[model samples]
Target: MSEVPQARRTCRRCVLPESPPDITMDSEGLCSVCLEAQSSKPQPEEELLESDFTRLLGKHRGKQKHDCLVMCSGGKDSTASLYYMRKRYHLNPLAFTFDHGFETEGALRNVHKAVEKLDVDFLFYRSTFMRDMFAKIVTSGSGAILCHLCSMWYMQVALDIAARYDIPLVIAGWTKGQSAHQGTPSNGAGQAGNREYASMSEATRRFLATLKQDPKYRDFPQSMEEVLKRARRRHKAIVLSPHWFLDTHPDEYVELIRRELDWEYPDLSYPAKSTNCSLNFLAMHLSLKHYGYTHYHVEQSKLIRANQQTREEALKDLEFNCPREFLASLAGRLGIELPE
Candidate 1:
């Protein structure tokens, strides 16, 4: 009895696996995405400097009770953002965490330590509103990306929190790959025009379309574009990431947070070395079952292209090493049984 083989073919230039809905490999083992990226006209890049970040902070500082609303996911990127907001930049930020019942204890612990050490105000919102939606994605086999929908929901929540506090800036721990221009759409709509996000965005849109038929989820924004529109009507806040303006790498900041804030990595996560929620294990498994790859592949590929990380390093981190029993445990929580 031999074990079943997983999809192993991948693009030579990036970590994208050979998947049909969006990716195809050439004879040379390069993917269509890589080829198109190579041929596309390079857009003029905006160089963000530390001075720009300082200036922006100064302008927004002391305008309200808090200078900014920092979204802390208990991940290294976000935890570091919270640390910097209070200590390095000298801004009084309101630390916000949204738990859809899938957040890991490790992540929450990191957040708890950071807020206590920094002595900043903290807001923790936990709800089951998204639990049904996530379960639907799994049972219905909608092939929708869970992370995309989750991001949309949380982004809206973050915007509302910022507005309630009259904060001018909604800060995120997004790396260079996740950062978008301020005042743009929240869930990667600004990047929809880019070739890399086109297919994935379309898939997410199609899944959201189906949601409109359900009475409970009918009002769900169909796209990040729509999310931004609603946000503008309710409140105006600029979304920013300190990582976009700072040249510091995760290696540098991970150490900083560990030493200064007592932040530690989680025991379990996909693609290795990341600090994702417990639900992320299920999400990555389903994503691979449907799309042959996950959003992490897209993010790491971008980092490789930007020279922030090497292809070899990204490849190593992108490996799917989750054990069967661990996945079953996560699925058991969702009341779904994994296929034998």
Candidate 2:
């Protein structure tokens, strides 16, 4: 019988393993990420008080047919955001969901149920506009981060939609991990600038730069920074997430959405219980193949640093739980076969 390979050791405080260049383990078995986080001085940050969120909502509410555009992914965080916009803040929100042909049925169902229950206008855009780009990433072996590229495309779409509808504020369900690194709390939503994300963002920017050389993708934004800059010049809209200000935990709101909006967790996900698109499994697999970890590891590590989630919980969620067959099926969709 073949000997089983030993599992790679991870940091004592976070889920990041000994991935070199970007991440490394020290003599104490703690990762460089953990050490840096430990030694860093806490900078003064403007606290995003709940009152501030309420005030922002008040400023935009009742100004137009739809006060805000809520990007609902049918996940717990986004569903809760939709619920709060309608029930808590009493704002007429236009719930928008974009499906790139890889969205899971569970997510779509969750969105349908939430909008029906909230009695809000819903916009579901399903297209294959991204399929060719996604296929290129796999076929050409360009180590481009799928989620980053997808976000660029979708963010541009969201900004255009907001402009078309005359919506002033666009809302997302991004947790603290996603936007906590913005220099100022006011620039929270859709911004990633934390130390942990530095290396990954650099990789994404480099990959996107190469992607822009293609005639088809020539118009694609060179980086997320470019995306935000262009959006600002064209149509100024403040993007915000309620999770940044609200003290509610995922468990707290997951249960609430389950009971109130009839939301059910997806049957399977790479990161255990996440409601990510089906293509995420392929993205995670490829990320782990090239880099030692996926962006989920970065996100979870941030949560661990914030004490929002224990290291053990993050490790559990970050475990490779998806079956090999599922990965093969997803890869087949892109006309690629996984090597044994």
Candidate 3:
């Protein structure tokens, strides 16, 4: 009889295993998650905990027409932001959502539902151009590189949409977990203070280059000249992250919105195909299978350190709930090639 290969052990924190996922161990036999918990990015010794929360509403506080262009995904974060802005801050925002072709029926319905309920002027940008671009990127079988393409495609589209609308403030629900090192809050504060053009500088260009260094996006030149040219065409657009404020207790804020907006808790809110977007699971799976951590692990870890979620909750989310059957079907829908 042939000797069967023994299954390797996985990280105690996440779903990553020791086999092909390549999780490294320290002298203590601890994984990276243990290290991350011990040494997270330092937070301010004192976070200005908001009481009224209206005092913290910089993105929505203005009488200017078309005050903000919100990239809402109809998830808890974006939906909470919208409710806060419209009901609490009373800002006039032009809501925008990118239809990435893989948005589940729930997400689509909720997008339209939220927009209608808010009664705001909403724009849905469905790009066959980007659909083909992403399809080609994924089908090319460039492992772990397609993530950059996905991010860049959305950002470029958002910029184009914001520019066309002449919207000054581009609001998003990006939590501080995703923005701490990315310089988003820094850029947002600068824009709020009206110091300089909301354009990418040499340093910013270099940072963006790191983000797009995946093989799929590697050949593309990261020219500040071209980025600047594009920025020049737009009115001053400052991307403000509402999620930054909710970094400590995002679910608390979401619950508040749930009550205020009378929002129904869908069956697939966080870990399933119900509330959260479905396409995210596929990306999460790829990130986990290749990098040994889902995007949610890195993202949620930051939030956990920031006190948004408990370590237990973060660990649960990092367990990688990729519905294998559903993912194969999604590949077909998005024209991504499937292995026989």
Candidate 4:
């Protein structure tokens, strides 16, 4: 028998680089994080978990006050939040989704299922300039550091909807996993509404003033009138993460929703969504190779710490090296070629 070369240790799914923190190797050539994740652990009772979530829902729920604008993406967490608001808290919320130009069919299916169950009004806003704008943002390299731009677009659409309808609270399915980097309860909506309102207000002014330095973003600043209006809204973007709150396993959570909601799984080769937002995946790939980390690294790391996912499971899900094909496609779409 001849000795064979040991294959480079990489994730089974998406391509995460070999150099990541707390990464351990197993005898089978798998990361310890993945192995532990594959194994299961005891969790809280689903009923009890549901009860606790209901209590949290009530704390934020207000019927007499204006309705809440729930930013839903048709994902498991957001979908579950819909049920909590309706069945548990009993708040009249209007569901909102931003057509980021790239949504999978699975995501779309869940969106419909969620709204149907709640029997609430739904809005899907589409930005005509998203495709071109996103392409430019991603390629400009500025997007890599300023991912908040993409998030801003999502929230802006939701906020505008809330403004038009006079919805005071803008509820979103954000949890500790989403904003773990910023240590606080207000992490859900970024620095939109903290006691530091004075500082944030001043910062926003300076930030917009500086926007003129960039020709691409010069005319993109929100007007002073718009800023004042947003401030008056006192928008309460509540964080709702039903999966984390429920204390259910990933597979079990999905199965429970699937069975309870009578939701039919969409048949799609591309893992559900197929929207105009292919650039998202492409950006992930580039960020992975260039920075040795994908968006999921920081994003999913929070979930791992929250006990939502084992570190190993998160590592696997977080893997996604920059694929050449995706890069080329994105470049062509943006009317650019890979730099020599």
Candidate 5:
């Protein structure tokens, strides 16, 4: 992908590319997001430690058939999380992966290999249930975010399975950028609580209202808040990610997984080094066009602010490269043409 889309100017201070209204650069080359963050008062931040994580894990370790259910995406962060759960923390985890028909072959392969090597019980669930919903978003020109909708659905899956299996913990691979509640005990409301997601969160909530009008999705929750609120009553699975507590540079874990579990990067992915589903290309396309940024930009921006990643590294990793032809092919899978 090009360093920056020619039409949009990027903030000099951060990696967020400008899109009017939502993100804009000032005369000084700083984007509105950076300015907003700068003007805000610094809150008392909590320091998390590996020992704290170990203590939390000890709360329910060996209490059930599986001490936790680790959501493995086969990406570096997630794969390494799976390895650490089994090897580092000495926890028996049920490895869970859900594919909505667009997951890459290499990503699935990585999950298979990691589970086998770790000797964890693996559950691979694949379905085309989401194809119709994605098709509607493309064909009908709905302003809904594909990723946001899928996140709700996927979280429901994670909750249901954990509750069914009576697992006490739900392990994800999220970094600090991915979860604001990281390191702190949370009641399960996630990224939706972040200021950066406010506008996009509203859009997704509107889309969910429309989704609920349909017979197939009439029971769908109207927002992330609704999803979590309902989940809290039925299950007590506290979600956690090892990366949240471990300050190890992501590069270190990537190398460790590759050397230990024979992990390999996928041949094709947007944002270098990621192994996300192929459908994410379309999700990101809609996100950038409608909201000026994707969730990765939001996450990477947080990393830059936190000093976990440099601005240059965030820009390089977040460089988007989905060509029109490739997007058309991905869209065609849902029997819809690419957006004009």
Candidate 6:
């Protein structure tokens, strides 16, 4: 196991630590997951290009005023995606954002700025529908990952909105490390078959299995798989991300958004410089306490393994800088006492 200080033992070669059955460390300090990956010969897919994005957009273009429904988080990746859709690809996109009552003021402001600068139709959905569920997870000490739940909710919302508007493409801000597709949370966090999310996903599934028994959440979808399955029956919309097609580094896009959209980073976030929700603090703390690392750790570690990021940078970004008292306060808002 790595002796490094991350408030837990981590793999020597990667940031992920000894979250057993899913992640484990050998005598050499390397993680078991990495070991398995090393032994397997995996095939790499073709790198997506701007032309590919253009071609895909062309397939659904002129069908409506908006060619795609851009899931703008008001973050750099999403803002840049909106910019590219408007300026580079010359495709009209319906900018969409949703807040389940935990969004930061800066994130919302960033979204508004990007939408205004792009001159596109914007749709903002704010609701506290999931607030009770969040509270239930905390108060009951459920093992479900908050981000996974939120992604499933928002993805269903995005698909519903796309279907209603007759738009055919759903644009997301996800990078390569974030997920394989928008249907799953970052890096298959809700995908039970994904070995990377093995233990984590199982816990989420268990919690969801129990959550489904409740009359309040009885109709809730069990997984991202279920959400996507239902959407496929009604919507022909295709989900994609600009970052996947573009080879541009995040730093470059951050600069572009800063100049064009007048974008600024959120003052508070789990991973530095990224725009995430306030509930993310509670999620991070719980994930760390329960699983030893958050999904951000998994994403950054993937980036490092892919040579897109360094371990040093990933560590710094995933470091828990918040005080325990503040995290407890966040839980208090949800009407629960944070576990020690």
CA RMSD, predictions in order: 2.9, 3.7, 7.8, 9.0, 3.3, 3.1
Kindly report which residue stretches of model 1 are placed more than 4 angstroms away from their true locations once superposed: 1-8, 180-193
Report the number of clashing residue pairs per model.
0, 0, 2, 14, 0, 0
Model 4, residue 129: C-alpha shift (Å): 2.8
Instruction: Compute each candidate's TM-score over C-alphas.
Output: 0.91, 0.91, 0.71, 0.62, 0.91, 0.93
Assess the local accuracy of residue 168 in candidate 2 as a C-alpha lDDT between 0 and 100.
93
Cα lDDT over the full model 4: 0.52
Cα TM-score of candidate 5: 0.91
Tens-digit lDDT string for candidate 4 (160-188): 66767766566666543343222121222
| Candidate achieving higher lDDT, 4 or 6 | 6
Taken over the whole model, the C-alpha lDDT of each candidate is: 0.81, 0.79, 0.54, 0.52, 0.80, 0.81
Q: Is candidate 1 or candidate 3 better by lDDT?
A: 1
Candidate order, TM-score descending: 6, 1, 5, 2, 3, 4
Kindly give the stretch of ten consecutive residues in candidate 5 with the minimal lDDT sum.
179-188
Q: Give the alpha carbon lDDT tens digit for every residue of 37-131 in model 5.
A: 88888655677889999999999999999999999889999899999999999999999998999999999999999998889999988878888
lDDT, model 6: 0.81
The candidate maximizing TM-score is: 6
- Report the error of model 6 at residue 218, Å: 1.4
User: What C-alpha lDDT, on a 0 to 100 scale, does residue 164 get in candidate 4?
Assistant: 73
Candidate 3 residue-wise lDDT, 1-340, digit = tens:
1111235454454433343323455655555554555685653553434443445456445646677788877776777777666766788888888766765566666667777788888988775444554455345543333343445555666667777867766777765534312322132333332111122122234444553656545544344233334665765576666656544466587677566655555555335322555555665455444444443444554555456567676656445544567767656767776443
Q: Looking at candidate 6, what is the lDDT of residue 249?
A: 86
Candidate 3: worst-modelled 10 consecutive residues by lDDT: 193-202
After superposition, which runs of candidate 5 have C-alpha atoms over 4 Å from their true positions?
1-6, 180-195
